[model samples]
Target: TLQPDVFGLVEAARILCEDGFAVFPYTTDDLIVAERLLAAGCKVLMPWCAPIGSALGPINIMALRSMRGYFPGVPLIVDA
Candidate 1:
């Protein structure tokens, strides 16, 4: 679920939403990515709890918190 191509994901999500499908996107710790995903009708996001395959936990707490702030009520799944 480590989708590096944010714009591609956004376009896909937008299409899905238009077709009445709920979109759950996986985003890195990029706030801009989250914003665009939300705009594309993503009600929830799955962000990395740590780098993929690193086995670390919540590497950037500040970034996570910032993402939460940016989304407010949006649900974020911090994938590990």
Candidate 2:
């Protein structure tokens, strides 16, 4: 289940676990996958607002907060 996608979600998650952070120049629209990652002790850093080359904002603060709640120790960064 590692390297979940060609974009390297699992690898990025691994690196994040090891390095405390990992950046992937792409987007993941699958919230379930993100939740799974969070459940696996990996922070799901994803965008909830806008799209690539758009303004940054928290489209769903509640969802972000919920994600945070799911992973109390994991850090989720929303980079639009």
lDDT of 1 at 38: 84
lDDT of 1 at 18: 88
TM-score of model 2 relative to the true fold? 0.47
Tens-digit lDDT track of model 2 for 30-78: 4566665554446345544445454555566676676667656645566
Model 1 stretches astray by more than 4 angstroms? 1-3
Model 2 worst lDDT window (10 residues): 1-10
Which candidate comes out best when scored by lDDT? Answer: 1
Q: lDDT by residue for model 1 over 33-77, one digit each (tens)?
A: 888888888899987778777776778999989888878898888
Give me the overall lDDT of model 1.
Answer: 0.83
**What TM-scores do the predictions have?**
0.85, 0.47
- How much is 76 displaced in model 1, in angstroms? 1.2
